[model samples]
Target: MQQHNDTIDSAASADEPDQIHEPRLWRDKGWTARVIKNEDGEGWAVEMIRDGSAEPALVGPWTMGRNKVDPKPLDATAHQTLVKTASEVIRRHEQQLHAQLNKEVSIDFGDDVVSVRLTITPDEFEPFGTLIALNPLGDVLATTNVRPDFRLTRESAGRWAADGFGKIR
Candidate 1:
């Protein structure tokens, strides 16, 4: 039933304070688990927030206590499970973002297979993309800047190579 008001101000450092283990809050291993009142309904909810992150990585309903009026106290097993799940959520998000920003395709051009890759850079004012073509031996044949919204597909890559790797229109 200890109390702690530690705020997530920055990434976990080597000199950070010792770990905290409370009934409703637990902080350790670069993650914090907090059981709070559920805003959507009557039951409680638990949130897992990683250090230095402004938002919770995962939030879900918490089990009710024996009396059915209070929330079950946070424990080590529960905290570990929450940490694993929240870490997975963050990992999936990163993978999805990477997939969205990068695309690749291989197509038969002339007598050889050419690998084409498009990487998008999301900038606030001037988002752009790079289109690269490589020979079967992984030698770069051409590279050019293109609109960020450019879509790289088998057909488009074939057309680009068929056009002699010129500017995409």
Candidate 2:
């Protein structure tokens, strides 16, 4: 029993993380890229994220090898090159997003449709997580911190659909 426990602990704290068919990050601080393949095999895409970005800073389609086939799986040698290419892609995307969201969206909410943008601000100080979402017109629709585990997008959409605020099902 003691030996088995030790082995489990060592494996849990292993220096390397095992990733197969799933993207893995070599390091957290520097540039990181995840290779994702289309389910239909139409094409491949690389989601590149850099330091200080909340989400993937850049995303673009990937090319195939000369044989007109998918490039080989990700490995040490290929990973090194990917880092360089992905970084440049992100540098370009950052410039684009910066130019896109120049100002807040103009909301036009009607009786049948509610056109609003919810900006969720999370409070991490308290024990129970708290998040406040404000609409583009600066309206507070709902406020809740009761449940720690909650999804904003799905829940909000479902509620709107159920309440007949969204398109009828």
Predicted candidate 2 versus true structure: per-residue lDDT over 1-169, tens digit per residue:
9999999967855744442223333333265567667555577766666656788755666665566656434455555666677677767876765543221222233433333233333346643423333454546553334333333354554464345443322
Instruction: Flag regions of model 2 displaced more than 4 Å.
Output: 1-29, 39-41, 63-71, 90-169
Clashing residue pairs, backbone N/CA/C < 3 A, model 1: none
Model 1 / residue 103 / CA error / Å: 1.0
lDDT of 1 by residue, 42-151 (tens): 99999999999999999999999999999999998999999999999999999999999999999988798889999999999999999999999999999989999998
Q: Which ten residues in a row have the lowest lDDT in candidate 1?
A: 1-10
Q: Judge candidate 2 at residue 53 and give its lDDT.
A: 70
Off by over 4 Å in 1: 1-18
TM-score of 1: 0.87
